[model samples]
Target: MELLAGARIALTPRPVERRHAALEVAMLGHCPGRVRLERLLQLPAALADMRAVGYGQAVDAFSSGAASELYNLPIPLQSSAEFHDIFPDALTATTEYVSLLAGNKAWLGLAVDDFFANGGEKLWVVRIPESAGQAGFLPADATQLHDITTLQGLACVLVIPALGVVGFPDLERLQIPPRLPDIPRVRLENFEPQFLPCTQNTEDDHRERRYSSELSDMPPPWQLPQVLRGMLQYVSSHRPDLQCLFTLPLAYSGELDSPVLDPTALSALSGYQQLPDRAQALRHVQFLFPYLRGPRFALHTPVGLIAGQQAAVARRDGPWRSMAAKPLNTDALPYPRLSIAQTLGLRDKPGISVLNYRNSFSGGAQLSLDDERLVVPALPVADYPVDRQRYDGFCSAEVMRFLGFLRRQLQALGEQLIFNLDYRDPRPRLLLEQFFRRLYSQGALRGASAEQAFSIRESTPQEGAMLYEIMLAPAFPIDRLFLTFANLNGEWRSEVVDG
Candidate 1:
């Protein structure tokens, strides 16, 4: 948005700044009639982040009516204690509101995501144990909580509890450390807004070493195939443009000692060398083609794996000794693989055009002592994995809107540039091609040759209506790095390869 704002300022006249203008932001708190009330909780932090980046005067879709009652205090409520004292009713009101929503099945996953995304200190969700009924309530079961995040198709939920939820007393006992509820230090695993770099694994200083909890949990045995199948189908349905997607195991929590199901056990159960490929896997999604002998890195890590890493490479020992040195094949993985570390690093790199789940704070971070969520001094923001796609797709859509405006203006003047009045005229098609060529000349698309950068093909499927297919190789971010090794004498020199 900041970049777009700058662009808007540069394109408009200097006098335009003097005139009053407003930018309205509208967002959904919940999908109407959906069995989910917690969908909009993550929205708060997202809005906060946007505001910090110069997006202001935006109205909240859910709570705009309450705006008149709210005030921006000169001395901001610095702590929860301050918030409690200033507005005693607010805490209880919020607690009751959360409790009511927490009873629903969707709340278990949505609430955790909301709390983490919003950087809240702690979130407690109470469930009535079946053995005790309504009178004797307890924190939700550990296994149940884990399943809520993993098996229940909520792998996107990041803050999975390391231990079961504990009991909490009334407001009077809240401040006392001993009497307060013992909410477990939930693992900020699986797609954290920030990550530690995997490159410096040898660094002894834990404080200096970086790590990425991008894929924290490993889903249950039966869940892996389902996730892969669904995403693969989605990509396949939207081919060419959506040919490939960056993926991590959405099965289990990385916080768990043993998050994923054993591949050997899976193979034994199925009596096959690899997990059975779904119907979608039988087809390809363009780009590279490789017959995967195993799914080693794909199941266990967030690393990119290619055909070169397959075990079959090791079998053919003629001249290609490097291939022979590779590890034994495990199972066939159908996707273009990269580790979470690599994926995060490429969030802003150029040239690459793959879709990934990475964010601004993937480099390194400090956990807020108050909230236990990632805190980057530069950009204190938290977002879900899908936000990467949303942000990228949004910018592209805005550019398209601008181009559409230009096209509309041309049509109003009866210029046969974007839309040809007569389908038989070759001048409109030539003009359209020249328009895109100008964009390429001005360095709009990502490529060396104009042909590689953009292309326009006219289609007339109907008698009167004309369709134009504008192809562009959108740029991708190189937010990750991989090691490159060169044997210098007896010592191997390592170099970094940007994605």
Candidate 2:
């Protein structure tokens, strides 16, 4: 038997080819630059099948087990979390600064303005009734919402207008500048992927930092903040409940020394550890402590080992408060429709996967399970980085590859599996970057602009979002291939079959 992309089975229309072996989808989008279309062995057929899918989209949507209307949640209105799009995954907007600082303050004002001007839809998020960001800190009047009208006028006048001029309060226009500023705004946001520091090696972190600074365009200490959720705390015996978001360089280890923990970590794990590898350690603990469950997520760094570390301190602002640092349970969140119509808001999204026939488990779009329902696990290789930095040289990644056997098994079993491997957003610095010549980019974009709408977000429209970059953000490009565990006798066997 031979597997085909989209987990579909396409034998050699010949009689001898069908009896020899089967196919499966061992891995999907596992490799970058290249892909393992599928494997074949001792078969009479000359050709086999292949398939693929893309960003915010998956083969599950097209699978026979797919549901039609998974994302049909109840209607909602705007609220506080929407403004500044409170970055659940971003680093501190400002931190360790004796002050919000002149440069930082201006940047803040500019960011809010830009978010609205570009495709940023308003969720009308407001500051808490008693707020967290400002209160007696900046002049009460200075913290005015987006100066939309002024910016819009600045549009052709100050900047460009059609980029959909957006501003807070009531939207307005811009007041163009006279020949642009000498220092064109440079927002070096890195929001999509940063390696979570699993092994807090201070030296290693610094080395990474130095590496970045060497190539930085900001020049000197005028660097951008590191957008990370370090041990951020809110001391509130008297101040308005403050919610601070800060970022530091990936190289900054909380420890002053030991920037790189193990220079030979990849070459020799045990050998590298025992050779007097003394280094300082740093850790980041993120949580909503006393957590609330509307919509919350952190900017997960594409870290190899530093898994997600989070906990919550509930209602610390209100009367009672306590703290706990439990690991996050992703399953608890509502698993909305893992469908294309729902994900892209369009009908008939397609997927293709190659099922390797050789594997024992082959055929079917899904496999029924002993448990009441079959569930897919979270994406593997959680910290697989695929941004500009990670791909600088010959870095190895746990890329997607296809195994023919598993492909056929999924199809025959008729199981609906979830495939959620996020490859969106850059680090905060990159997200906020303005590496362009235009005064205003005409719209919100990370590297370049595109017409893609509907970003994957943690909360409401107000809170910051994991911008759904279009074709530019795919971890795996759209291919007409996929395979399933149709052959699996039960779900347990299916899960264990593939790593």
Model 1 is weakest, by summed lDDT over 10 consecutive residues, at: 371-380
lDDT of 2 by residue, 1-499 (tens): 2449865974432222222111110100000011111211111122111111010121224233444221111101111122222222112333211110111111222333222232122111111111112221112222212332221111101111111111111010000111111111245565586676888653422121123223223312211111110111111111111111111111212343312111222122223213321100000111010111112221111110001110011111111111111222221221111233232211111111101111123442221100100011101222333231332111111011111111223233222222232333243223323221121232212243332311332322345433322121212211123434455566433222211
Prediction 2 TM-score vs. true: 0.17
Error of 1 at 455 (Å): 2.7
Worst 10 residues of 2 by lDDT: 23-32
lDDT of each model, Cα atoms only?
0.27, 0.18
Model 2 / residue 297 / CA error / Å: 14
lDDT top scorer? 1
TM-score of 1: 0.27
lDDT tens readout by residue for model 1, 90-171 = 2123222111101111112222222223222222232212222211221222323223221111111112211111111111
